[model samples]
Target chain A: MPHRPALTPLVESLPATVPFVGPEAQERSRGRPFRARIGANENGFGPSPRVAAAIAEAAPESWKYCDPENHDLRAALAAQLGVGMENIVVDGGIDILLGVTVRQYVEPGAAVVTSLGAYPTFNYHVAGFGGRLVTVPYDGGDRESLDGLVDAVKREGAPLVYLSNPDNPMGTWWEADDVVRFIDALPETTMLVLDEAYGETAPASALPPLDVTRPNVLRMRTFSKAYALAGLRCGYAIGERETIRAFEKVRNHFGMSRLAQVAALAALHDQAHLADIVTRVAACRDRIAGIAAENGLVALPSATNFVAIDCGGDGDFALKAMEALVADGIFVRKPMAPGLDRCIRVSVGPEAEIALFAEALPPALAAARGG
Target chain B: MPHRPALTPLVESLPATVPFVGPEAQERSRGRPFRARIGANENGFGPSPRVAAAIAEAAPESWKYCDPENHDLRAALAAQLGVGMENIVVDGGIDILLGVTVRQYVEPGAAVVTSLGAYPTFNYHVAGFGGRLVTVPYDGGDRESLDGLVDAVKREGAPLVYLSNPDNPMGTWWEADDVVRFIDALPETTMLVLDEAYGETAPASALPPLDVTRPNVLRMRTFSKAYALAGLRCGYAIGERETIRAFEKVRNHFGMSRLAQVAALAALHDQAHLADIVTRVAACRDRIAGIAAENGLVALPSATNFVAIDCGGDGDFALKAMEALVADGIFVRKPMAPGLDRCIRVSVGPEAEIALFAEALPPALAAARGG
Candidate 1:
């Protein structure tokens, strides 16, 4: 065999598996498009029209590289969050930021903590950096166990911990006071990466006020959710100035797209559109719950743009239902972790797509039951 | 001071410095925009109109995340490059791919080699990953020294080496046969990151045929140059199948902006526009050379989108001229390295911007001469 350069042992040991297989890949393999594209928890209602207009306007100026400082978008976020611009570091998305954060904090064989079935992308980053992941199972209520995470951090002396409020896979959440209590309980040296990607869709009470005084907490927010600019790939982390400054040491500063900045700024400016989206998302949740009830399933209370419906059976049953729905061209997803796997997750979209999901559910349920 | 989480020792050791300060940062500091935006080697002729149309058409679909696999874009690239789809890995840009490559190949303190004044972003990544960089000086002709780089790689036993053909900041190139010889001379254990971001603007004879059989060589190309989609943040790497597969082990799969894929695919389909841009860039390079001659400066032969004009003095003199040009609203930059710093680099742009540069050059040169 010809000699070849060897990958660092850490990277070589990593499994070449993606965290999520996107619906587009499914479409390619299936040889047909999903009639309802709602599997990825994307804001299928789409970005504000103003954002589209801004993107169209900026398209002609696509030659310019993005501002490395991300000054304008960070300034806008600072104003909106009532924090200093230095407290924010905007990047491609929460996904890319997670990798950066991991690189900053994780050394080889270092421990990192997260919920068992939390965002797989975060787990991917931890593994990519060779961090030993110590997972805490979700509580009986399907919420991330704050006490468990604190205990794991103390036990492993983990440098980083991840928590996604208004959680993924299972849409349960903790109110601000409880979250604050959890924060107070963590070891001071343990950094908490509080992902609030779904923040805009959740109730205000579920979010704690910005606390830039704490050096260990980094709260990440994105335009991808209720802002409906997922494709724009813009996200920001709010933290103490020095904590945010650490990003500058390792970030690909010019990695952001110029149009991402323009689209995010326009989306942020349209508060009226955001409010409308939130309202529509709440209504869609109820509609999905109603559809679940019609199918003899239970829908979990959700503070996010997506609803997780318990299929009144087991993980295998939910998987069967999800596959049936996918086969019928109604794109939907299910949680795969043991306890959470009984549920199928569906994101809220425009009425037309949701109506398609509603129409496809009964047959999908029948197929799952082999009736 | 309150207790806080600490950055890893490696990250703490790294300084918080950006690889290159963007022109936008300068504009913000100066409280005005430049008349000629040609400093960063961005293709100011802009992307194909077809790409803009594609972006506008796809703007409403901004809610969807990019296809994590980058299937369609990679397929197109593979078809164009005469390689299997598995031989390609697409990411945010060449900047990001550099970081990923460094992370994959360089262990902490591993030696990495590059031309002394070559791409700083690659150096930034090496430092960020705790790799010790070994620099090789350019030859007397001001081209990257292939023999010197080979010597440095052998001397340092460097795991990774970076080469940007039709190089940046100097805009000089070596012919294809020489590049192939350089590649052949390297030990197979040392990976060569061949950055061909300027490849599209160079003569076909300047680029070697794609040879995906070599696991030690990764050839990176981007839409940021000739295709003029820098704002889209789309670039790809071509390598042997297993080598390319290694990227999937660590990359942020969904980090690419959805519209970026649309824009790049559309840009690739418009070869006629790319050909037109290449022709225009050549003419503009000649125009810049003519302007430099009129100003009593020597314009270096360039095979890229930018030309470097020697100010016929030392580094300090070139710095003064570049500053004067910047003050006059002509955004030009100069090399800061020892031998290379005697020149100011200017990118090709529309006639209006070039005219602005032309008008500003005489006063800038006079200012440099203490007029």
Candidate 2:
């Protein structure tokens, strides 16, 4: 190949990879849409009617650029969260926030700690910023090993650490007090990104109170899960006043679409709709667990919108089962990392989707077992 | 004061600032909306009716995430531009692309080059990434000094350079051949970001053909300009496949909202609407120039939706004039950097809005002069 313009030495050395692909790509590849849209943990229950109405109403007004300050939404969020306006900074989602936080802290070659198979998007940003990853294996309970992460952070002297509570894939969570202890133990020099993207569906016991007094922790929450606003892409971070203000340094000023702000603001005000979705998600998880028990398998306890069920075999068996489900037009995903790979991840959805999963799992497992 | 968490050295060292206070925020502070909203260079004509209809249709589907690959839009763009899909990367807008490009090339402490009073957002990104900025003053002429920029890049061994053709703030453009020479003259180790955001409005002779085969030059285009989709925030970069593919290493996979994709695709197909808007914009630009002449001021020739009128005084006089116009409920802005500060920027709008500007300028000028 002829010589070409080079990426910065750091970017050039990085791998060419993506953390995840949306289910739309999979459907396109399949040349057909799935019968059950319960994959990727998107709110198949959908956003509230009010949210959709707000979107439609605001569609024409989109000719004007979104206010870069995001004043109205931020003020609304402050009022709702009982925090001051300066305590919050909103963006497209926590994904963008993670990228920003990494830039704010990790210099190239700086150490950063995360779980072994935690949120891959976070890892992507860490590597993109040339931060070295110091990943700890999940605790045997399939929860992020907070103590191990703290140890690694101190050992590596990492400037940034990431954890997703009520975790994804496995859906296990650390309790509030354990989380508080973990926060207290961390060095002030290391910033903790507590991504509670699934916070809405999680039990109150799993969530610590949002206190802006702590400068070391940035709490990230999203409307993508229970609010059914995944397509809207609105998320925000809460931190001490100065830390929250720091996001303004590098955020794309006009990045958020005007309609997204409207959709998110409307969603926040519809607590009844959120409560309904959370109840539906919880019931769906229980129904999925019961279905797993009927099949003589085990479903992991979950605090999120998904359930991970063990196939009572190996990763290979789970892989075949997942593939069989896809072939049966029941879209679902499985963890590819070693220990986590024994389970197939199924998202909690409406009865129609959960029923489809129940109908397909038996035949899919038979195919996986070649019975 | 309590010691809350500290920002990273780079972030703390940066100022708490925004490039511009949004017009909406200004209106809120002033307790009323602007009568003629022609300040932010937005297309007052708005998006195509078809695009608005498409957004309305897609609003309900906001429950699902947009395709992370942006496959359909990329395929259509590739077919339109005679480039392969592998040669294109789409993002929120040119501002986001500039920031990502800066991150891809400039390491902390490395030099990057741009015109002193050019796009402040690009400079914001450079600082966000800790790249030391090396600014070249515009030549005595209003246009950016291309020769001076090239000289500075070579002298500083800067890894990245930015040049907005039909440049923002001034609205001047260079012909395709001159731009081609600029690309060819850059070092193989350096990257050039050619922002052709206003390409739809500029004369065809001014734009180089899309050249995705060039590894170092990435031409950024947007739907925000003549396409009239600013609020949607869709933009793309065209470059060699090798360079373009690297964006996969570090982008918010699910960041592009579903509405943005459908709206852009619809706008792209409605070329007649775009052409109509361009004609309307040109006519308005000429009218604006005439209005400026009537007021005994000079209107810099504009190939953009906005024109800068030389106030024939210092920066303070121009600023005072802009403030007075705002007081008259006509939203307008002025360039703030030293050499460019003597001009007030006004966006082209409908006839009524133009008349509003015509009626407001002389009185505002008189008031400003008296003050």
Candidate 3:
């Protein structure tokens, strides 16, 4: 009813939406907190004690802006990954890095490729930049189809392609050899965004060796998953020097939180804590799979910190099951693509939360079946 | 050279440059830390102890992703600002918000306007978005030329104009009445980004009351300045509901750090701490002015955490003086525009750092004077 400023045509064409509804928003709407917060693929095991200490120590110095170059964090990551400092660029998180990557490689109306129902945040970034998405459906195994993605990239001549190894929602992955084959198959001019956000949770064999000399590939890693620092929003892209340098052209130079730098640095230094979390995560995944079996569902084998439990029903049924779980004070997400929509995703967490999910699943399943 | 993936035309056209060379990069290059960290306009007084405690308390919870909606912090800010939740959008910092604002409003090759040497981050965003920047020289008093900005907007038919009250670099401000006049004179179609980053440090009469009714105006504020949480990277924009809603279309939805939310909430709740810091900032400004006077330089009246001291010399002379200070282990920065370039900006800080600058100033000036 009032005069409003005009948004750019590209932005005007986009819809205002959050790619995922956070548990907090659902809790606000429900007027009560969920009993089990095993959703969103966040590591519920929490960050290392050293990271907490670093954050505490860094908190008092909040009056100083973070290093725009992100020098120390980048240096630490470089040493840990056996890459040069020039090969890495630290950002607020993998989500922000995906956005910048889209801006760097995808022009308006240019075709971008991704597996259908892989990661919505990457799709969000692609659409935000006006890149026309060409999605390839996942293979029958619910893994991101490496062959299908390569075919789409070659067919559409897509300039940008996104592949999240040990993928979100389905918790499925391709082996490192297959990934290398896919990379070699892609046109050299087409950039591949190899999202390894869950790399720490996956088996080492699932990850291709770090190769910063490849100009067309950028591997993304985050503190959010296995490092258990999702709240800090720190991640990095490892790539060729020129590819890494391109982020400086458009990134918010002072965008990083100083505590994120401190916390991530501490986390990287604490490999024992990470190994401990990985062991816990593996045990929790087993617990989640056992819970799935008790409810007469099959939990997909996972290389991620979450399991996708096949609901043995249609999308509508899966949606109802997810709703029933939410109503039962449990937070779980489901894939919405045609083939993958029959599964509900539950993130690995501490035993207490896992027990809550175990307690809630049977009734939730019954409600979906009956109602 | 190795083959590289092609960047988009827009990205390829942009250059790789940071808006500011952070002190950390300087330290790395210089092979030592500066004796005084007074550049970048950061608050040297540091954040409240309560904020530190909140960050420490929130540290372990970094396993949970921040509420993408930023519900709690936004609600707290809404209550404090007397606005509805829909009228606010929280961002990483003013720097990130500026980038989003530029993306939402400025189409490629479209004219956008600001003072010649205001915040370089805003200009960086404009360039990143491929917007044509129409620059207006600062008026005689070193304040942003309100009339000059309006005329350029009208002449260029620019869609966006930026004005920082209690502005950066020169540390000059326009009174509320004049600001209101400038707002009223702007074309209804032209969106105004009213940056009030220094509002908490300014005289009460200098800030117009928060009004979320204007769809064409967005008032930006941050915890970075007077709140003493620059490193945490939390800032918010207040505008009409529709204007603010547009930000959701392009923002990195999960970009806000959870600890930043925790720290900002604590900072907002502790108004007494803010008042204490404001008082200390005022005293430090006076101390800086006294130091400038002692050195026969005139300090501009400042409503900010920084003072702009006129070196009473040309731009080249001021550059030499700033370089001399840098070589002397001080990190003070100077405005680089033709007219405003005669002044070097020094942030108000703890007495020791300020004293370091004071100790370095005489010799730096003498070196610039060819003694």
Best model per lDDT:
1
Report clash pairs, candidate 1.
Answer: none
TM-score of chain B of each: 0.99, 0.98, 0.98
TM-scores, all candidates, are 0.99, 0.97, 0.99
Worst 10 residues of 3 chain A by lDDT: A1-10
True-vs-predicted CA distance for residue A170, candidate 3, Å: 0.6
Q: Show the colliding residue pairs in model 2.
A: none
Clashes of each: 0, 0, 0
Candidate 1, residues B1-371, lDDT tens digits: the string is 43999898999999999988999999999999988999999999999999999999999999999999999999999898899999999999999999999999999989999988899999999999989999988898489999999999999999999999989879999999999999999999999999999999998999999999999999999999999999889999999999999998998899999999999999999999999999999999999999999988899999999999999999999999999999999998888888999999999999999999999999988998994
Per-model DockQ: 0.85, 0.65, 0.80
B138-157 per-residue lDDT for model 2 (tens digits): 86747888888899999998
Q: Model 3 — TM-score against the truth?
A: 0.99
User: Regarding DockQ, does 2 or 3 come out ahead?
Assistant: 3
Q: What lDDT tens digits, residue by residue, belong to model 2 across residues A1-371?
A: 43575677888887877788777788899999999987788878888989888887887777789998888999999998899999999999889999889988887789999988888889889888888999988898488999999999899988889989989778999999999999999888789999999988889999999989888899999988888888878899999987888888777778998889999999989999999999999999999999899899999999999999988898999999999999999989988777888999999878988999999999999999993
